[model samples]
Target: MGIAEEQSKASAALASSKTTSSSRDSASTAPAQRQAGKIDVLIQGVALFSDGYNIQIIGYMNTVLAKLYPKQMTTQVKTRLSNSILIGDIFGMLLFGLCIDRFGRRVGIILTTLFLVFGIILATASHGATVEGMFWMMVTGRGVAGVGAGGEYTVCTSQALECADSTPEMRRRRGMLVAVSTNAAIISGFVGSSIVSLIVIAAYGGKPSDGIWRICFGIGIILPLAIFFFRMRLNDSEQYRKHAIHSKMPYWLAIKFYWRPLLGCCSAWFLYDFVVYPFNLLAPTLVSGFSKDQSMISSIGWSALVNFFALPGSFIGALLMDRIGRRQTYALGWSIVCDFGFAIGGSMIQLKNIFPLFVVLYALFQTFLSVGPGDCNFLVSSESFPTPLRGHFLGFAAAIGKVGAAIGTTTLSEALASFDNPTKGQQAIFLIGSAISVVGTLCVWFLIPDAPVNLEDEDVRFRNYLEANGYDTKEMGLSASNT
Candidate 1:
């Protein structure tokens, strides 16, 4: 049943559960109570920017690391290097996911950012007497950093969503706000790493050195360091203040009420990342394939340019989010990308030769990838559930997406190796990605629901659901602002 219908059904009992001392009306959806300040936007932006930069920057440095430590960086080692952060992310998501729901967003974001700073410092300084030892140290550091970045995925998203949900206007635009604020921030981080890597390499006169990779890993620390301080000044989102379950949580009751959405959000995220991470992490490698003799600088530059196209796609998705709804925007972007993937992969031979035209086509393909799935992933995942357990569910969904990314990333060399010709392997990727996008489109179409008619609609409905099932709604949402 819809939230509105459920809210209406529970209206009679609302007075019994009203807050004891707070002036804000529990039943009202008024704008005067919440302003959604610039700090909200700032926190979301930097948190995501730091996250994107730290996670994707490692992929940008693979070639440089391979050059510096070829003996130690074998195929198996390469896979471990790429997947370590992803593995770390799953752990962080689960741990902090539950932590934030139990404690508060303020606690989660602070700890996660500290993890980012500590991980980067350890990674940037990674060294040992033996070359293999150094590589091992770097991998260990990145895995820890990945944990912090992974935790940010849920904390930033839910915080930003709540911040934007204070008014009718903001609630309608909540999808856009969360997408633009957090999801789009990731593209910035990802693209920034590509550009920064090229710059760092050029500074060393196009040669690989210990300093180059160290500088690349070390530079990411600044953003998170700043994020840690800013997060401390913040209070938990008002929604969290009202609906958070501080005492013993009704886990089985929540499962009974939310299992369908949990399944849908988790699976949708997995499918999106399965397509997104491979295409994303492999963009430079794929573009480099188009030119037999292009310098490393040129390939990376082109990849940066192609990834830059994601900005426009993010803006487009933000515009469509409230206008058309999250489900429609997500399915629409994937559908178009599905066509592009087939066309580009099927015609790889001819397009690869034309060079400039191929970049444009591939760029347009990446742009749309940003538009739908890119934009909607964070926003949709957050909106799919209620506030009390948003951190838990959202973190779980994101962690699942990382799993898809790890699988997809590992598929890269393995998939390519299975083919005889380079063009055939590349073609296989496009066709596979296209087929996956088709499945992704259908998954969102049926499984995910549209967003709320009001910001607290789900929270209110959740209260009714719990109270009817013998859970205490008032004992929950203990104030965190004071403690």
Candidate 2:
């Protein structure tokens, strides 16, 4: 069948399934019961706040740590410290994703939370007799925390999307809910880090204080631990439960069936991170580099200010996805917003009199990214596969994306160092980032297919596809309702 014909069939199937599901929905529960489901969705969405907060805290630490331990903040040391969490994330995404697929989402999330708590405690208490010991300790702690935060991507995102799909009211708003949940967490991270920074600076009389960094790391423990209590109370989504009860696709078979989406999601995420992490993690340094007169506090405050603009951009992108479709949103954000921003911003970075212009362009670049591929990537990864493989696919894609983040974080310093002038080096990195964004745009356009998927109908379609392909549906416990 032609691509258009296939899409038309899928849409019709989804519409019919939605109608049927709506009829059954009124009979399935009382009004209070429905209201409770909405509450659950909200809780799950908020669960991501910890992940977002932790990720950005590290970025904020770049400036704070540089001042607190200037001796150990060498380029190599800084790179190691910056990438520790990301290194952990690389493994965590893979491990937690597999755990969710095999053991269940609840189990995976609980374990992830425990790791997060342990990592936070280790990082908060990090100290040693020598600078080496202290640096490694912090790196180790952040790496551990990164593992938990990494797992959150697979566990939390999959759960939020699944929960949204389980409810009719939420299903239509899944794009916004997922995007807002993740982006809100990011915004919270930016806000939380800024508040903590101001408080620490004030208490210490604006001096470089180790206690400030420790306190900031320690504060990350609160939200995750609190959410753990609620997550334990929550149950797996109806879609996952149904899939788990009826059938489990073999790992190899899932790979065989969904390789196209795996490639699309993985590449898209990889490219997004490749461009995003370098700028994001280096935001403080970038701002500081642009204007030598800017203080540490000013640099951090500027970084936070840039992130504030990202909040609306994220919501706008999600809303556009619902209205114009994911492909268009992704393409527009990449080509128009991110690509142009990076190219123009890089070219202008060396302009001595127009430093503020560079900052504005940089902020606009980030804002456009959040609107386009940032949150949309998560939505695409989760929705691209059926329930049985959703976690696995999303996890794998996320893990690979982390690799991109790691590369971006690691190489950015090297890129900056290669040039004599810091501003010129930053210009080089930004131009390179723009080139990478262009490649990412092409990947989204050609590789990622646009399919309007309804979760219930998708499950049925997968079941039938398996059966028609000579797989034993009966053995897998496929039921009429599931089809």
Top-lDDT candidate index: 1
lDDT of 1 by residue, 37-148 (tens): 6567547878789788887887778777777878877767777888888888898988888999988888887788888788888889998999888888989999999899
Question: Can you write out model 2's per-residue Cα lDDT over 27-128, one digit (the tens) per residue?
Answer: 443223222255565565565676666776777776878887777789888888778888898888999888886667889878898888899899889888
TM-score of 1: 0.92
Our model 2 lands, by Cα RMSD against the true structure, at 4.0
lDDT of 1 at 147: 90
TM-scores, all candidates, are: 0.92, 0.89
* Worst 10 contiguous positions by lDDT, candidate 1: 24-33
- Superposed model 1: Cα runs more than 4 Å off: 1-35, 479-483
